[model samples]
Target: MGRSIYCVVTAAGSGTRLGHNEPKALVNLAGKPILHHALCGLEPLGDLAGVAITAPANYLETFTQIAREAALSYPWTVLPGGSSRQKSVYEGLKGLLSFEPGNGQLPANDPTAIVLIHDAARALTPIAQFERVCQAVESGCPAVVPATELIDTVREVKGDTFTRQGLKITPAGSTPDRSRLRCVQTPQGFAGDIIFAAHDRAREESICEGEAVDDAVLVATLGHEQYFVPGSMRALKITYPLDLKLATWLAENPDRD
Candidate 1:
């Protein structure tokens, strides 16, 4: 049996990049919405205790209605998210822990075992990959994160600001190796109690971690070791307008058994 799993899907972004008034997750990805594909993929993971979805504050109810029509087959609640993506993640996590008293600061007796944090934009999350996150947590790591190996040559540019079109950077020597790097993805699972504590410490210590990729980065600073699960390209996130075409392509050619 799988642990008591709570999948938190973050869908708070306005579809500015996707070029729509609808939330990115609500945008059509075939016959269904991007969020529908995500929830479809997530349904196989144990008894989906609950799903905490974050959406734009104004459209929270709109997304909630969309979720209902998707027939997601799980208990879900829509949470109004924050200004930034990381802040949105924190808000979703808080909603998951709403089941706990005092807002996620309780002890082991009332533990929520494993929590899976995913993105609604990444509609292509595969069952096999999600299984990998659960399997990794079974070994007792305080946190478990999924990362696909990087295969590109990345560079670091120095100076106060970047002259490049969109890439941003910090001071010297802050860039990580492309070879050694793993492009992180979500539903990164964690020991619920520990991850909650980790986020708590992060809030206390004023650590920004710069929206590293997923929640696991913030958890890492809270003195927890993250175990990596091999990831797949099928789980790519649909963040840009071009990604919509890719999602349509994926939908047309699913490898579903």
Candidate 2:
């Protein structure tokens, strides 16, 4: 029997970059909200043990309505989010703990239970990508994330100064080998106990808001190695206006993938 799997969708981001007054997850993509698309993508994983969505406190009702309409098979609820993404995720993890059977923490006898932390903005992440992350965790890898190779040249710059003479270029920067760099994506998978412990430690340390880039970074900070698997380009996060438009186009034309 497979261990139980739970998901926490971080949908509390303000869509300032997307130029929307509402939360990014509430923004519509091809008639349905982005959160709807995100939840639908998780359906292929079979019935989840629990699903928690962290959204703005003010819009909890709105998110609740959306989740109800999505009609997912598993149990789910909307949670009030915190000021920062890191805090929001922390809250989501806590919410999951409340739902887990027994002491609201990982059961020592069953360490195979897994948790997937995903970004709601990445509405189009393929079901296959979710499966890959889950498989890696079930295979005994404590931490796993999906990533794609960077095709662009990356440079490390020390400093830059501007001058009236057509902006002087500084030679203090050097190009790093792009071959070793991989652009990471979510849903990042982790053993239930591992993520719970990581979040608990971060809170106790009062880690600055947004200090860790992603859940994987927090896990890595605890000195755990993260395994990587290939991710789909279609899983791109919806941020800028152009990205929203492109995602809409992609949704309308499924044959393109």
Candidate 3:
């Protein structure tokens, strides 16, 4: 068997773009909530040890009920998330590490254990991608994130300042080679101890404004090299209403792309 895997799925986003009253995770996708679809994506990981889900403080019960409805075969918990995604993921990591085994005690912390950090908004991620990430981590990749090359022409803008009309004035600067750039996606996998330490370091240092950085960035700051695996277009993050419409169509046609 490969390394045992744990998951911390962040679902506290208020889907203002989805224009829904509920949190993004609670929005309907196909026949179930977006969070349900995300959990289902992890079902293919044969060594999934446990899962921790973080949701809006007021919606903990609703999230728990949805998770139960998913009928997951592995141990899982739903808890209140922090104000930001990074904080929420840290909370999830703590919650997952504290999970009680069948013997009623916290399992010993295994440095080599694998942890996957995923977003509930990426509900359409294929199941095989989860296993691919875990396998990469198990194969000795300290940090692994699924990424895809950017196809469209990219441009850099300089002189970032608000215009008199309240529109940010970003004049076009230069075009960077698209071949060197990639759009990253999650369930980012990492060695358990490494990722946990990285998060703890991030918390202690109070890096950046509002902790807007992702786990991969945190790991990079810690000087750990990260490996990239092939990401799927199906793993699109549902952000705006148009994205949701596309996701709805993709849900109906899972075999495409």
Candidate 4:
């Protein structure tokens, strides 16, 4: 039998960096909310066991409404998220525990079950990347993440210099080999039990809320290696105002691929 897979979209981030008054997920990409585009990518995965979305406490209703409007066939629910991204993902995983499986209910330890944790801010992530991650998980990889090779020279910085704008400029301390570097992207896939245990262990160790940048990082802390798959440029994370503009262009030009 094929494995059961679930997805958790973490959409609770405040858009402070994006300079928006609303949550990043609620910002529009095309004519719809960024969360809408994120969900749309997952819609093609017809066999998804279930879905969970973590939204800001105050915006749960708004996010719920958007999910309902998407009219997905899979069972989905929105939960109140925590103060930080890591905590929000943990909350999403906690909500997934209640998901009803096809066999009846999810077992306490289902090694065959897989889960994908995605960032709602990456509104343009391709559906193919989602499939690639799932295929890797099904092929026996416990942890998988999509990544893109870096095209620019990346340098490590040391001493800081000040600008009139108060922005500190740090001189390059050293340049790492770009061939060994990759810019990672989301919809990181993992074995359901493994991720649940990782999160539990993180809590027991009192890991700070935002310390781990991604779930894969937490899993790596548990000593598991993550396999990487090719990620599309269209999957760029929308952060600054320019990112929003780029995402908007991609949204309007779906045929560019």
Query: TM per model?
Result: 0.85, 0.91, 0.92, 0.94
Over 4 Å off in model 4, which ranges? 103-109, 161-171, 208-210
Write one digit per residue (lDDT tens) for candidate 2, span 1-257: 16688888999999899998999999999999999999888888853778889999999999999989988887787899888888988889878766646334343123577899999999999888999999999898989999999989988877675467956876667888999999999999998888877877888886554557888878877899999999988899999999999999888886696
- Per-residue lDDT tens digits for candidate 3, residues 113-209, read 8888999999999987887888888899989999999989988878885678977768769999898999999989998888888888888888753
How many Å off is the CA of 217 in candidate 1?
A: 1.2
Q: Tell me the deviation in Å of residue 205 in model 4.
A: 0.6
The TM-score measured for candidate 3 stands at 0.92
State which candidate has the highest TM-score.
Answer: 4
Runs in model 1 lying further than 4 Å from the true structure: 99-112, 160-177, 209-213
Per-residue CA lDDT of model 4 for 13-32, tens digit only, reads: 88889899999999978899
Clash pairs of candidate 4? none
Better of 2 and 4 by TM-score: 4
Model 2's alpha-carbon lDDT is: 0.85
Question: Over all chains combined, what TM-score does candidate 1 have?
Answer: 0.85
- The model with the greatest lDDT is 4
**How many angstroms is residue 164 displaced in model 2 relative to the true structure, after the best TM-score fit?**
15
